[model samples]
Target: MTAGSHDETLAVLTTACAAVGLDPSGAKPIRLAENALWRLPGGIVARITRAGQHQPTERELRLARWLSAQGLPVVRPLPGIEAPATAAGRPVTFWEELPPHTNGTIPDLATLIRQLHSLPRPDFPVGRLDPFVRIRDRIDAAVTLSDTDRDWLRDRLADIQSAWASLPEGLPECLVHGDAWTGNVACPLAGGPALLMDLERCSVGRPEWDLVSTAVKLTTTGTISKTEYERFCTIYGHDVLNWPGYDTMRAARELRMTTYAAQHAATNPAWRPEAQHRLACLQGHNGPRPWKWMGIV
Candidate 1:
């Protein structure tokens, strides 16, 4: 099923809900990106991903349980439900809906990353961080990209891949939250500790990989103020920007973000302008670092 098909996603949600004995009548879509998230009745949230994602989906559930057991704060899978049920070729999992929460503060995310990076590796197999995963496909699927722009993106991707392979050593490898952004960290409004959400990318990798997500917000995207960025570094106890390999990591991350926008624009035309802007920034049309990039969705 296409990632942008709302009706088709609803059908899959309905089937998955039926399988789990839940009503989908009033399900509300929370997000539609790599995964489709629906807020359902009874404080349960459902996540649906493309077909063939069952393994990773199951790993996310298991990882959540493990993290919770480790006394780490993570969004929990709904109890007593056999999840990753397949419907319409999509994999579905259920999670307990969090209380009304604000997006996490930069410091909140920093703390979570520190905690996550300190954990011992999981016993189960977690594939190494594939920074380039699905990137080529995203480029190819970007309907908004012109042939010339597509070729440029492909060349950029190749260069970044080479750079990534030769990245200098920084921090020791640990459990890295593959995507550690404020959006993935939730601060409950009802008086509770902040919780980490989205385990799809959690894996064992260099802690620098997690730290760079926030670092680039300051150096590349210009989203966070310097004071906030400094606070994040101090709280996390390490500044990725100070690491020798920061350049390569930053380039890889920027490329990924740009391609993500391009891929999204293919499905949602409203994102085309931002996607084109990101592409142009990468191509040097915008000049130098710290280009302003609006968050996409």
Candidate 2:
């Protein structure tokens, strides 16, 4: 029942769809990262998470309902379906498919983030953020990494963990979207309001944890223009770069991105070059900041 291979994933999808009384005949894979997503017929998106993820998957559904109740635009779970169904030992949830949409603009993302941060914490236990979640596993499971490189990454992870523990006083803790990249926020092509997608990592943590993603893109990868970054800062109110703990957070984020690529590279060899480049930059083998790192799918 392990849903690693495409065939296994399809089997899980089929079982889950049957449980919900939906046909899986034309389910097409939309993405395969943290979760295996499939675009089901009739404008539904089915998500299958790794085995033993039922709790978080349930939490995601609850949070989505809560956010929508609070008048915040978010991707909604499919109506009339009891989600987080146990399917082939994996957790499966169905969502209402979003219309054609583009990646949210920097300002759109900043506004949504600010709005999200302004809300009071949820009534249910949303759990505290664990920035290091799955990090060590990624390091250990990355088959493409050499033992020397693995040791270096392990040491770097430890250093960052210590740094995180003693971060300088900054903004108050609140519900932070653990991953706030532009892609996670969808801007409807039909000119409707932007919607926040991907709720699994929604948890309470330092607001800076959310902001660091954009800051890294600006300073480390040079993906966003300075103008866009400035607008993001102005909209979000209070620049993350000015915070004393910015460097530590940035380093932690970069390390996570590196390990993520490395983990994926282990599965898809095509990703090895980008993964190695990212690791080299962190190891100081590639020259200083702004290494022109490309985004991996």
Candidate 3:
């Protein structure tokens, strides 16, 4: 709430730690987003969220544990600790600390994606994400998108809707590590390779959805060359379409992100500028042509 005072935040963390039978004597808070995360000396972390945000935080922690159960290297959350009731009366949760992987090399990164793709789709309707729903929500949340940019999303949505029936379906939907960007992945640790964190976005969907998300992240960040987009498909062994309806999803992703950035701008101004920049690029008005290097004129 009011910028999270150190003493008050520490009290919250201490409560969480005590509930889990750990002493919070020397714990220091680790900044993970707007929430406060405290690290005990021995691989224990308590994440405290104020009222209203606790539910999502709880969901994220559970999802992380579920992913860990699937044997996909992920941070496992400690179970059964109700979020400490603060003056705001919100729920908080804690999780076991995951050591960082020191070897987040390119080969490891490729292997990680390959392993994730190999896993079968998780059964259960976690959520539904359509282009229009995503775009509309972002717009409703007051994300600033130029008229042309908004029009671009509309055209992409129309294309996907029209081609929806023709697109592959029921091939093999599997659990996607939803937000598998490098930010959620850490370098190699122990005898294993890279580790993944932040599973709040996990869902059952076409494997290609995750692949496309990963590819887009890499593409947008210049982590991989434009040519590598096709290489990724080849390596991951998925159907490569002319566009694979990426424009549709990209627009949706940008919209959601822009909304989030705008909502959090007061405390995170950096994100607002980034959101504006991304909005400009998606509108095709103020950035390099993302599809140009792919020879799309």
Candidate 4:
């Protein structure tokens, strides 16, 4: 997160805690991005998200409660409390703080994902994945990008949107952890196995879409070792690359990742080079794999 936004988060945290009669003093900041995360001394984690993100925040709370009822090991919002209150006009939520543990591994993630996919769909409203929603914002946020770059990005987004519309179903559409990836899973929980977090994009979609994140990390970036990649497939019981519609989905995923980095470059200049490299690679001027993607604090 940028330095300028830190104060705003602290101020919002204070106000929100005061409204609930919870102490905000000595709260520790965890992450600051689309949401501002703070860990309160009372062992609860507070999430302050953008005001426009209210609906998703509400959906997330519903999912959390649902997961808990299913005996899932995922995190849960605070019980017996009204949530998603406006803190400085931003939506804020409280979660039960989990005990410290090692970061979840790819195998751990695959196991959790398998369990998640097995469940019948919840009664709550959930639509299919929408990869195009962030395109406009990401494009507009690239304030310093060249006109040519901007044009190319817009064209790519348009092409992907069209392609996504007709994507053949390889795996049966299931309730996926929409943003499933190693980053979204936490290690063995206190009473359960691997834990999945980040339910913002939880929706019914191609099961393969969730696996694309790992596939990209392995094939496109080569950040993950081949042995590990194979293990992921073995555990998950399918190699996504061999799926007929894999390339199409992978391409769309790459474009979204590229656009995400590009959008952040406007506020964090360090993201520009990586963003440019990603765009160039997509255009076939392939840079070496295992890109050093960093700098979005």
Candidate with the greatest TM-score versus the true structure: 2
Query: Which one wins on lDDT?
Result: 2
Q: Could you estimate the TM-score for every candidate? A: 0.96, 0.96, 0.70, 0.93
Q: What is the lDDT of residue 266 in candidate 4?
A: 80
Name the better of 2 and 3 by lDDT: 2
**Deviation in Å, model 3, residue 120 alpha carbon:** 4.8
Estimate the lDDT of model 4: 0.82
Output the better candidate (1/3) by lDDT.
1
TM-score of 2: 0.96
lDDT of 2 by residue, 1-297 (tens): 124666778899999878878999988888776688989889999999999899999999999999999888999999887558888689999999999999998898899999899899999999999999999999998889999999999999999999999999999899888999889999999998999999889999999999999999889998988898999999999799999999999999999999999998998877899999999999899898888898766
lDDT of each: 0.89, 0.91, 0.57, 0.82
Candidate 4 global TM-score = 0.93
Question: Model 4: C-alpha RMSD to truth?
Answer: 2.1
- What lDDT score is found at residue 243 in candidate 2? 95
Model 3: lowest-lDDT 10 consecutive positions: 288-297
Query: Over the stretch 79-116, how does candidate 1's per-residue lDDT look in tens digits?
Result: 99856889988899999999999999999999998998
Query: Once superposed on the true structure, which residue ranges of model 3 sit more than 4 Å away at CA?
Result: 1-8, 53-63, 79-89, 102-110, 120-171, 189-191, 218-221, 227-231, 239-243, 291-297
Clashing pairs in 3: 83-92, 101-187, 101-188, 103-188, 121-174, 121-175, 122-175
Error of 3 at 135 (Å): 7.7
